[model samples]
Target: MQGKALPGFRDFYPEELALRNHIFAVWRSVARRYGFEEYDGPPLEPLEIYTQKSGEEIVEQLYAFEDKGGRKVALRPEMTPTLARMVGERAQALKKPIRWFAIPQLFRYERQQRGRLREHFQLNMDVIGEAGPAADAEVMAAALDIMRAFGLGPAEVRLRISDRRVVVAKLRHSHHVAADELVPVLAALDKWERAPADSERLLTDALRADRARVRPVLEFMSGLRDGAAELRESAAAEPLNECVQRLGAMGLGPFVEVDFTIVRGLAYYTGIVFELFDQGRSLRAICGGGRYDDLIKAIAGVDLPCVGFGMGDVVLGELLKDRAKQPEAPAQLDAFLVAVSGEDVEPVLKLAHELRDQGVAVEYGLRHAAIRKQLELAAARGAPRAVIVGPDERAASEVVVRDLNAGTEEKVPVARLLNGFFR
Candidate 1:
């Protein structure tokens, strides 16, 4: 038997890391385009942080343990807790509606699935002071544009959105559901899509009322599926309607929709919630977030309105791979320097150094090797061009540059080579 990475962990070799880096680059670029500055926090935080936000039972899914100092700590499973803490500490000093982003490697002790890993990097972008529907549109737009940057179109992914608070209000006002029963009923709605029977069961159990009383609630839930017009007219759904219009005005209307089923599973989401899923429904959510208006206040005693989303690299990378949107790993070097003979080594080293200092990626064999072997090595390393330094060229202060792929050679003076080839 051979040793391997832990069951849910991953080992990213060079080629694999290229894809990860590409995702990060696109994440940062898209985030910056939205004026969201990057930020970070420690990977480890007090275990109470997680417990406080999600309750003690959440420890079962967290990589939690006590340290030598007897302080319980855990790898952060999500960025919102840390963001809440950080924002709370400086809420008074910082500007309103803080626009910040972080690419954090989150860890969780959970069963492995296609897109769910033990550890993965996630892009967290949050607006921490705005409560308007426009802020929701902005965060949603950032998530959508990142997918767009990877060449994914609206056809590949769609943002299914819902507002738990608004829906709860509508249910309470129209269906006569009590405020005490909202959470369980909302949970039912969250699962209503895949398990309508289970949802009905849960809702009935929570309500303890007859099926006649629950009929309106179920109709309300059903209306969310394809009832954009009717629901949009309701005052309870005005914020969501405004958000839809905002996205439409921005031309991202085609990428998003209204679906009350997206309660986000987490209890913190208080306003418009959404999850981006593949059009084919073949994977877990590629991204998910929504308004957590009071979470900051509850966690850190700072009541900053916040809207954000977390897009994990694991599911996204899988989605990109499936769509063939991932870029191929970059080739090794811009040029490889090969010495024709022992006497030509010094000039080759000098030119290689100079070229490197000039910002060109250049590589050469460390020990003396045959010219043929050197060129072979260059090709093996995927160098596009090879600079052959022979006695004749060295004597003439020139070098022969061979295009590895084109199989053509050209001679240029060492002084002019930089300007000609690199330019």
Candidate 2:
């Protein structure tokens, strides 16, 4: 039978793995610098956990099934729900404002495209037990720090910030939309940038379809963007005024701007939503998060106001590639030992190991090949120095070192070779 692989799945070869590791290392370093302790959970969890928090709508987007024991299970599509569950499991013992970060492999059953994969890695950062604007600021700062660490400046990305509370309150106060219909309209707003005309049509249709129910919500969004002058003319401007003040106090007012349009796709968010986007808005969100103050209490029966953000590795990688700043090929080894004759192999191997033990990345020529071939291989591997141990050199208890880049050669006593390299 002919064999074929899945369309959206991919395999990582050695070179690709090296690059991925490099990117992950940078993420780890940045997370550590911000004092975020790393934590992890199982890749598989009960399906009901996600359904409970994200709603069954998420089930259509997840890879879920019933196990042999008939227990519904799912591969995690994101980490926040799992984090919430874990914190709930130990709510009484944990400290406040728990700072944690994790890089987990998340799976989603979605159409694969550039920067969107069925399987990908995401860096999640969360601050629990605090609901103040400062907690929100810190999370936003960390997200910005990550982008800067990747050499991205404000011009490369912008954090579009909004308050879900403001969204709801404005909708109810100005447009009088019912609570039940809020979520679907918000989901549509989240897609506005990608499908502007369609989103407008959907919003308009939703409002006309249920004017009494949806008009207030539409009016609220309109007021948020353009009706602000008119709102100043009205008396119910406290919420919008407070939102602006809080954003300023958080010191994120410049990096952030009110995007009445930013409705994060997830249903769990309760307040203060924001998303990071490329300057050109040509790609998906690089990161996004909002307040889920009631999630911990609802899930674990312990109340904690938590805010966090998830930065997916895939989109960031694409951004780096587009900027022509992807990590370069890793440095080659310092030395390569070439045994000119089969008899010299043992000594070459011994010397190679000794150099490695002395903190040098060294490799020994293993194939049975001529001296010229071995030297060619060393050059191709980008070895800065080549160590040639021939029968004559062995008899004299000496070795020859050739500086590949400089084309310089010297003979040194075998025992002094280590000292010479170290020097």
Candidate 3:
């Protein structure tokens, strides 16, 4: 049998798992602070749930197969479809503006690259049942706060935000792109920055118009990336402007920018799309999402509006390491109990149990060992203190407490030691 993790998966050792836990802690803390409750669905869901929301072509990226029950299923690649289904099942019974978040391990059968794996854990935060810019601002705030919790600020990360309505309006009125051809044009625009010539060809083909018409559209799109397109006063840009204003009022203005180039490339995104990127742009997007007003209706026959984002751990962890924000693993033990002689072993065990019961992280050798050997083990485990129960100290109802780091020692009464002294 092969003795390694699958190409795009990971094996989180203690240190790696600690980092993962730290990321998750920050995610939960910020979500709760924003009054967003955590929720999760089955890791494996009906395949149609995804195809229904994103079309049949998405099957190319799914970990899908037929099960023994003769039903088609797939490991979830994203959380939005499941969120819509869960919300729709009891939409009327739930309160307005449902706030929910989830940390799910998502799978996708795709090529791996820097900051991208076939499988990864992602934090998904969504606001449902609200259709206004307030919901949009709320979701964006939560995402930004999580980045802040990780010792990141606007200078380290940037939020590029846009509104599909604004982009569509520009295409219709200025570029003369027809409604029937919007989808392909949007897809081509998504590729514009990465492959300008190819994207231009795609745009030319999708528009089926004169080559002359495509140049104006390309120039307009270029201006959006170069900080030359100024559409803030346009009516279609109102919702995005309001969202940016809300973020600004909350003092998150420095982290945000009105970049029309960020269309999110998702067909379901109807308005206010945003992506979080490292300021250096050294990796893939750390997060991306937007409002999908008709997605719930399309997937579950419910007309609730929703906004959310998915932040993956792969790119996020890479960014943290690059920015020197990775966290250290917590100490394994608070104290190590040592027995000086055979006679003191029982006292050492008793004191170890008492300290542990009092909420101290205590550890000791499972069997008898020399005092020096036990202290060495304690040091290896990064225990800060070692409690030595010697014959004389045990007789005097005391123990010698040694600070491993400072190399200091003191005699403490057993009674004082048991009463939450170590903690």
Candidate 4:
């Protein structure tokens, strides 16, 4: 039997890897442009990191077990807990408002889906030691900038913004819901758009009330989905207002939409929360994140306000393909060296290494082969040009350069070819 990649996993062939690398390049470029330095941690960590942040329920979705040394560990499902632990270790000595980002391959044990997977790579951008709306706006702007870098625009993607504070305020004041019931209500609200019936049933169960009593709360939440402008009347919207205003000042207003329903479904999001979606709403969130002021303290006993977002490659790759944004695989070689006869093989080897030393991606036949066969290999490898070395040309201190795509050939001085003339 032929072995296969596990379900919900992928095999990144050269072409697919090219697209993944393209996404990663854009992510790193935009993150660095925003002054966020790249960082990484071990892919495997203590199992408690996931369990502590999300509780024991998360263990069911983690690839976890006891190690040979009797230590419980798991492949990290998310990067935030790792970030918190790292930052917390150096909190006092590190400079304020730390800006950091990581590209990690995360693993999860879950059902396979179009966007969701058991294993995937994610771009995690984070800001630590800052608590204000400016930090919120900063991360959001960085995310939008990445989309722009990928040829996505407001017309193609929408940044759905919200704040946990605002949602809690509306739930408590307007509907008089108790603080104790907020968790269950939020769990329902997180799934409200995808499964309204389930959401309502959960909400009703949480409130311990009949459908009639839950109707007003449902209506209130429905109105919030209208847009951000609807929430301005509440003082709880202050932080979100400033964040949106900051985005507006940066000319990113068109990509931003306020919605009170984006509570992020997590208990730790203490402040602003948000998710990015394709304007078509055909896939899961392209990215999602929020402020969690207490996570560092919980994980590492260091209190530092933080805001961040995780943009996974799986869904983003799907979106890019849908929108025709995937980049072509880069040409594998600048030139291929061809030996016309046994005597020319030595010079072909020498010239190949020389061109490579000059920073050109040059390849040549590793073993003796026919000149025609060599040219065929060059074309297959996507080499732009082929440098043909023959006894006559070698004697003249020159070689024939054949353009694979144009099917044109020209004689070039050996010195010129070695000096990056082709490059």
Q: Which ranges of candidate 3 are over 4 A from the true structure?
A: 227-229
Clashes of 3: 0
Which residue pairs in candidate 4 collide? none
lDDT of each: 0.89, 0.78, 0.89, 0.90
**Of candidates 4 and 2, the better by TM-score:** 4
lDDT, model 2: 0.78
TM-score sort, best first: 3, 1, 4, 2
| Model 4 lDDT at residue 269 | 82
Off by over 4 Å in 4: 210-212, 367-370
Clashing pairs in 3: none
- Per-residue CA lDDT of model 3 for 223-319, tens digit only, reads 7766424777789888888899999999999999888877675667899999999997988999999998998898889999999999999999999
Model 2 clash pairs are: 175-216
Clash count of each predicted structure: 1, 1, 0, 0
Instruction: Write the residue-wise lDDT of candidate 1 on 321-378 in tens digits.
Output: 9999989778769999999999888888888888888889999988889888998999
**Candidate 4 lDDT over residue span 299-383, tens digit each:** 9999899999999999999999999998877788888899999999988888888777778888899887998899999999999
**Candidate 1, which segments miss by more than 4 Å at Cα?**
418-420
lDDT of 1: 0.89
Q: What is the alpha-carbon RMSD of candidate 2 to the true structure?
A: 3.5
